[model samples]
Target: MEKIVSFIANLINTQKQFIKDLKELKNHKDIMVKDDEKLIQQFIKKKAS
Candidate 1:
């Protein structure tokens, strides 16, 4: 029983860490998309002018 509990605790900890990493990755992706859009807009403005 004790070993089972320990295993479960470890699994929960790993899952929590995975979730945190996933959130960070999503945030990073959003920032990259926004940066890319800004760059494209600037390019278009330059071309128009």
Candidate 2:
């Protein structure tokens, strides 16, 4: 009974940490994508000029 409770608590904690990490990763990916788009646009403008 105690062991089961402990196991469940650990699982919940792990899941929470995983969710937090996933959100951070998603945010970083979005920033990178936006930066990439801006870079591409600059490259295109330079090429055009």
Candidate 3:
């Protein structure tokens, strides 16, 4: 019984960590997308001028 309890606790912790990592990754992707958009805008302005 003790072993089963410990195993379940470990699994829960792993899942929580996985969720946190996924959220961080998503935020990084969002920032990269915004940066890319700004670069594209600058390129367009430069081309127009």
lDDT of each: 0.63, 0.63, 0.63
Of the pair 1 and 2, which is ahead by TM-score? 2
Q: State every prediction's TM-score relative to the real structure.
A: 0.56, 0.56, 0.57
Q: After superposition, how far is residue 12 of candidate 1 from its true place, in Å?
A: 0.5
Estimate the TM-score for candidate 2: 0.56
Model 2, C-alpha of 24: deviation from truth (Å): 0.5
Displacement of residue 34 (Cα, Å) in model 1 is 12
Decide which is better by TM-score, 1 or 3. 3
- Model 2 steric clash pairs: none
- Shift in Å, residue 3, candidate 2: 0.6
Which lDDT tens digits does candidate 2 get at residues 1-49? 9999999999999889766654554465444544645655544454478
Q: Give the least accurate 10-residue stretch of model 2, judged by summed lDDT.
A: 25-34
Return the lDDT, model 3, position 5: 100
Candidate 1: global Cα-lDDT? 0.63
lDDT of 3 by residue, 1-49 (tens): 9999999999999889766654554465443544645645544454478
Best by TM-score: 3
